[model samples]
Target: MMMRSSPFWPLFSQGIRHRVLPRSSLLTPRRTVKTLPSFSLENKTCVVTGSARGLGKEFLTAFALSGARGACIDLSQKDCEASIASIASQVQNAYPDDPVPELRAYECNATIESDVKSTWAKVVEDFGKVDVLVTAAGIVDNVEAENYEYARWRKMLDINIEQGHFVLAEEGREMLTWHNIQGSIILIASMSATICVRPQKQAAYNTSKGAVQMLAKSLATEWGPRGIRVNSLSPGYMKTDLIKGLLENEGKELVGSWERDIPMGRMAEPHELRGTIVWMASKFPTKPVNPA
Candidate 1:
């Protein structure tokens, strides 16, 4: 049995009512000071995995074009050298007067955590800091689910899911935190994460990309408070080394099927993603400070 409260108990006679205003009424107009940062990589240092060829090469070239120094990390030092040379020539030709930013190449197996760490350490020592990281090392297998070997599936998981989703995200975050730099991390996911390609059953590839998408979301949430922005870019079919096989083979019917679904009705060229890479590396526009 509970005892009754006295009549003099200090309860609010107004009943603690809240005045709920209409949504539109609550939106009062105010003056704001907006600071819009330029989408330029003027003084940034960018680290690009799989920078030997294909999409990685495009990213390296794009960053160089935007005035950013680049570190090309790939399995083959020779290929990395070629990529760096090409980027230097392109930048020199594009900006005849402007000094070309320094570009270095490192032989790194992105799937190996130790290799990645040492390579990043070398980069930081050489460049002072890394303002952006692009994880573009990945592979695709077109084997059917039933016929796909366990070893190949493991390889896919290791290269795609583990390297970008785990290794790069963690190591890059650590580097950013240590340098107190608000760095940008860009992971390459594929549109296959959304729609499965017909006539080609790459179950392993599709699942790995789906995992990469989720990994980006999770890393973004965890690192947002720390000023590190993690994002995933999902391009549809691109005319890169990864898809050369399908494009060259008797995939006319499959290509038609994909084209019909795409609004662009065509595969993207690797260089077309340059603008996006620049935008990602730049600081986002500041939130306006509203005046009363």
Candidate 2:
């Protein structure tokens, strides 16, 4: 037997009510469910500058692994072809049953505007369209700012900033015209753009990379409404041929000091950035959401 409580209990609970809900309703989610966005680059055509070697080749390999048909652009056609062949072999081995994506080599001096235009046109002719473009053709040098030669400084800016801009512009024209295919453009900047690297002076390189980041921001704003996404990838120190050479020549002690400063206590491998490159090239949301 249960004892009755005070009648005031009902009065105190006037604003509260309880109702039994169906088990199915209780189990159901309130919000609509959605599937995850795919990162596969199937049926996509990609163009990568500096694809002959180093980080550029790594980026191209990432795209290939994602099932993208690619055009490898570099200063030497032979080198580009060799890189593509290596990539083809790797891709085939990875996807033993699947056919390797078509990969072609293209030669172009990115610093030259006319050369960039012709090479991009040829790429479009061969691949029909470019869905993604990664401008990785750049060089770095270490020299004290005061002693840096004017010619060397000019060359640095020409190759990194100017060349990247021209190649990006040409790709933009191709994407905007012809079939008006919306595309993604990735500019490979550097961590030095944000922070001054120590133990070595690369004022020109850092400045150019900073400009590359700014260029991406400006283009993203200009082309966002047009369905093109432009972004810059600023990578920290990676173990590439360039960095390897530096470590060997600059002495292990000096380079090792910098390596110790890294959060991981070591330099990143080239393959570590492959996922990032693939994600950038793949279809994903590029729009900014309003907080309001």
Candidate 3:
């Protein structure tokens, strides 16, 4: 940032220097804060579910931008194709020379036990070992609690809750047995795990997130000693594609309430969550590894 002499600065400083005015009498120039450069995530193989669009797509891009080999997984092969093409194009433009990323698409219904097992087995086969797993794929539907269909409720629970468990369990087993080092498992949790979602009734979604919170802590404790770390992130809403329409429809007041609830004054952007995800995935850079 270039600093320029303000038209009034010399006059104001002259006043202060001559003891005619206090230093606070004039506005001071503010220095621009420099942003920290991104670190290398090269050689890390990460699996991000629901990479076809929205939050998932953002996560996939972030992983690639950070120099990691990424696997983009979603239910539809067509969606994955579009996602892969988009990511490839974006990375190629960004990096140009070192642009060809080791990213592939996979289709798996995370809710099914058999599907998770096969999908993870293939993930390991292709990537060698899973260093980081970002479980971003999920669905949300809001309906009056009393009139909520049982099938819909069950579907929410199975996909959001059971599916997370299956993926973690499958990957955890491999990381513990096949791999010699610890790995990280990050669950894309929501503030609903602690705070209640008002106005609309999403009892099923809330409950599923609540269950994930426990699952994360339990797995962390169980695997901590074995060099594997587990943690969950509960992010407030951001301007993701899924919620963009709602925010525009419901107006900013509905989103602004979260600022009142949390210390931050607004919802988190998808990439804003990236720092925490990477930190939790890898061991802390400055801190020594826990031998326990």
Please list the residue runs of candidate 2 whose C-alpha ends up more than 4 Å from where it truly belongs after superposition. 1-37, 288-292
Residue 41 of candidate 2: its Cα lDDT?
Answer: 78
How much does each candidate deviate from the true structure in C-alpha RMSD? Answer: 20.7, 22.2, 18.4
Model 1 CA lDDT for position 118: 64
Judging by TM-score, tell me the better candidate of 1 and 3: 1
Number of the top TM-score candidate: 2
Worst 10 residues of 2 by lDDT: 1-10
Better of 2 and 3 by lDDT: 2
What is the Å distance of residue 195 in model 3 from its true position?
0.7
1-292: candidate 3 lDDT, tens digit per residue: 1111111113333222110111221222221223233344556777888778877787777766666677777787567767867876787687665534567677788887888887776667656788888788877767778988999999988888888888888888898888865766777778788877766577888888888788877887888778777777777677777787666666767776656765667667776766656655555633222110
Among these predictions, the greatest lDDT belongs to 2
Q: Model 2, 158: alpha-carbon shift in Å?
A: 0.5
lDDT tens digits by residue: candidate 1, 264-285: 8987899999877777767762
lDDT of 2: 0.76
lDDT of each: 0.72, 0.76, 0.68
- Lowest lDDT 10-mer window, candidate 3? 1-10
